[model samples]
Target: MAEASLLAASIAVLVGTVAILVNRVRTPAWVRDAQLTLNASAVTSLLLLVCGALLVALVLAFGIFLLATRHGVVGRAMVCLAATGIAHLGVTVRRH
Candidate 1:
């Protein structure tokens, strides 16, 4: 039962992260402006793409951690980190 709950929670976080990435990609200009405030316009787009890729990498890392680790402090910590990422993404999504 506990394992099931943990799996569900991990999946939810993965989905949320992907959703946020998709929404950000849909508005490249906004993402560039928001993420690279001081950078030149020419480079902002590339930087934004890097940021998106980084987020995708983070999600992948977290997913792998969740899958490969056993239920314990490490698992709980990963879940907490995932939740934090989701909440941060939620705020970012709302802002733009």
Candidate 2:
């Protein structure tokens, strides 16, 4: 179950990673405004993205911890949640 949980989490994160990598230019939307308004200033957008990414990273780390501790269900849930966040972070017009 733990292995399966890790697999699912990795897959979820991979999907978002692919979405981000597929873009040749830019994601256009950062973490703040998923609608791609681009209303935030350059620095502001960058900051928001950075902050959001950090938050996601923290969640991902926690998910990892849960997995290590053999909390399969919670780990899977947290990891999936983090992956959705990252996907939205990359895909645009969506929020985690």
Candidate 3:
């Protein structure tokens, strides 16, 4: 579980970095005062991407650990759920 959490945290950091780059690329000048919309979108996207990555990574790590210890059902479920979350994030990123 602890290892899982660490993996999740790493994923979040990676996603956050990507988000920052995306924002930098999309944001434009001269709309500074009313750039609230862009700002909000960037923040929300960043958060969502990071959270999704974290959840997926954590579940995946947990599932792998369980498998290593020969815990079947629990391990499988975690892996499935993690894959689902990761897939969702992949779709979201592609859409944007």
Candidate 4:
């Protein structure tokens, strides 16, 4: 269980790092516009909003996964949930 959790966290970090790199290489139009037009405070608030939405989405995805899998693997599910939170925090920190 500990190994599974560690693996999930590692994968999440890798995914988050790749996402950040990709985003840096090719920013979306809306994000670019927001960065350009918004002040620091506004941008921070927007980031928070985006993070919140992402967290909700992650929770919903995990919930659906649990339902589909019949909740047979609680450890794996919990690891995934933790990974999602960690990845979100990583991206948020990178942005800041």
lDDT of each: 0.60, 0.68, 0.67, 0.60
lDDT of 4 by residue, 1-96 (tens): 865565567567757766775576366774566455444686676787677767756765775676578663554555456555656555445454
Q: By lDDT, who's the top model here?
A: 2
Q: Per TM-score, what order, best first?
A: 2, 3, 1, 4
**lDDT (tens digit, per residue) of candidate 3 on 2-90:** 65665566556556656654575455542343345435688787887898898889889998999889876567666766766765676
Every model's TM-score: 0.40, 0.57, 0.56, 0.35
Candidate 4 regions off by >4 Å?
1-72
Clash counts per candidate, in order, are: 0, 0, 0, 0
Better of 1 and 4 by TM-score: 1
Residues 21-76, model 1: lDDT tens digits: 66776796966776565344646555755575577558657755765775454465
1-96, model 2: which lDDT tens digit per residue? Answer: 776766677776767666664562254444444434555456666677888899889999999999899987778777877877776576432332
Worst 10 residues of 1 by lDDT: 87-96
Q: Candidate 1 — which pairs collide? A: none
Candidate 1's TM-score reads 0.40
Estimate the overall C-alpha local distance difference test score of candidate 4.
0.60
**What TM-score does candidate 4 get on C-alpha atoms?**
0.35
